[model samples]
Target: MEESSALPRISAVDLFCGAGGLTHGLVRSGITVRAGIDVDPACRYPYEANNSAEFIEKDVNELSAADLRPHFPDGDISLLAGCAPCQPFSTYSRAGRSKKRGLDWQLVNSFGGLIRDLQPTLVTMENVPQLADHPVFQEFLSTLAGYAVTWSIVECSKLGIPQTRRRLVLLASKLGHEGLAMPEALGSRRTVRQTIAKLPPLEAGQQYAADPLHIASSLSETNLRRIRASKPGGTWRDWDPELLAECHRKATGTTYPSVYGRMEWDAPAPTMTTQCFGYGNGRFGHPEQDRAISLREAAMIQTFPRRYKFVKNGDPVRFNTLGRLIGNAVPVRLGEVIGKTLIAHVSASRGATGAGSGNAQNTLF
Candidate 1:
């Protein structure tokens, strides 16, 4: 480690970068996020608008190292950052989810190929903790043994995100570093109330006229009674017998109690999923409101800024489209921690090198 050598500045390209969640965090940490690449056309507007990074709409499987090289310089501390879409491993989608012909199953391999070809200075990936046991994840790891790598299953609540999501975060460097420093925990967890208390409230299935994105899906009459019976953090077991779903009334349905429940105002919300805007989806119902958590609230829980516009100028905000983009994003706080860790690691390495050089020169004299 030579003190005379300057630390390399980081530049990154985010693959599977839906709505620029990771990019925003990297940018905030002062990394030059060159671009965000995703296959979803719905992601372009928000990714471009909220972050200074370019949005590249393309399938990562189809991307070549040649396609990615032009975005980064010939030589620098370039980072290939990605959070490959994680639906196949998701518990919610497990009912009928199959790996056969699923595009997501192929992405980890594609990510490996890109790394093999580009050989970027560093790599970082985040995904469901379940990925560690999957063969695709093992294959991805096999490609990185030449580099210093470390990964852990992290509790998102510890990282200041207002949700109880867990993820597998991995970092690797070819620059003589072996692993990343884990992000420190906040003094206290942020709650759903802390994240969305100030936003204007909305009625069921109503849009806040002033801010269209601050909207909630409507509840059916039966759902209305069910929600009314729902105590904060309580499940359908608390509902009146008349309102219980047929499945719930059966002996077999006792284990699925988190559905049709309400989030507690003082606790972190449950993981935001693609259908989080629906009343019957998981525990998405609002703590105090008579409706499900709105899109804006859901985004805020994911730690997206309040003003992040998910829709284009004339586009309508559809649940499935925006929900997928939002739910699939890496939490911005986690990204910031990752970005800052890289910076600190590079800086420390430079300082250590500089001190070694001074000692060597003294020895020579």
Candidate 2:
């Protein structure tokens, strides 16, 4: 690690970089993301191709300090960002068992392990807000002994995300300065209308030719019929009694009518989930389109750039794969906010010590 006096070059090594959402945001914030690590091979093409960052198809637990050091050779001001698989913490999971199933909670501990081993200048993590109250989170925070830590449960809409998603973000730095707070909201929240209404109309399961971003996921015939009966922001109650599922006739099913509903044009979208492309799943219907939101629409609400490419020519585009990637991503806008906060902390530390050496061109929106 070189010890030049210049404001340290901010470089990041992203862990569990699903489809490069956080990496994209970090790049937008002017931070150089040298590499991204994820276990899913499906992430390899998009993560590397879209972000111009090296993609390592490896599990976080298999990563060694030696493997990561190469990406941060200078080690001036390195960032370790991880948003581990969230199935264990997700409210949508049907498994009532412990987090040991395919969705292991221990993965979050691995992130903590990496932070301890690398001792990077900064660390950031994003996950479902419920994680903030989890025991693992408490342990991870307690482990950051010398570092200043600041965190918040932020509503995605407040940060200009077009979905009503909430996530827990934690930022920490080894410098004595307190961790930086998230940026204030830019303006009033963006609604579904503001985000996607301008796009050309498409029937259920249709794709637009002019804009690849206008692609919509197809629906099953039954689901299509169900969607037609569904109202924006309304529930299964709006359906004909004959259309209701046996489960819906039960008290428990009736309690959660928001499922299989439509988004209100004027309101933020429901939280994007791994199943968001399925019209039968959650409130994923387009306000007026009578179909599930498209892959492009889901990406947009997740704060991805409209033109961000997800696949190369001729590559298969499966809804399950893309939906999982979009739902599991750290919204790019939120990533920018985190990146800017880190830059400010690092720059302020360098300035106070009169050791500024690197150019301060990094901008956080």
- As a whole number from 0 to 100, the lDDT of residue 342 in candidate 1 is 72
Q: Number of the top candidate by TM-score? A: 1
TM-score, cand. 1 vs. native: 0.90
Model 1: pairs clashing at backbone N, Cα or C within 3 Å: 1-353, 1-354, 2-353, 2-354, 3-354, 205-217, 205-218
Query: In model 1, which runs have C-alpha deviations exceeding 4 angstroms?
Result: 1-6, 92-103, 352-365
Q: For each candidate, what is the lDDT?
A: 0.81, 0.79
lDDT of 2 by residue, 88-168 (tens): 667554222222325366678888887888888888988878887788888888767778888888887887788888888
Candidate 2 Cα misplacement greater than 4 A, ranges: 1-6, 91-103, 210-213, 352-365
User: 334 in model 2: Cα distance from truth in Å?
Assistant: 0.8
TM-score of each: 0.90, 0.89
Q: What is the lDDT of residue 116 in candidate 2?
A: 83
Alpha carbon deviation, residue 24, candidate 2 (Å)? 0.6
- C-alpha-based local distance difference test score of model 2: 0.79
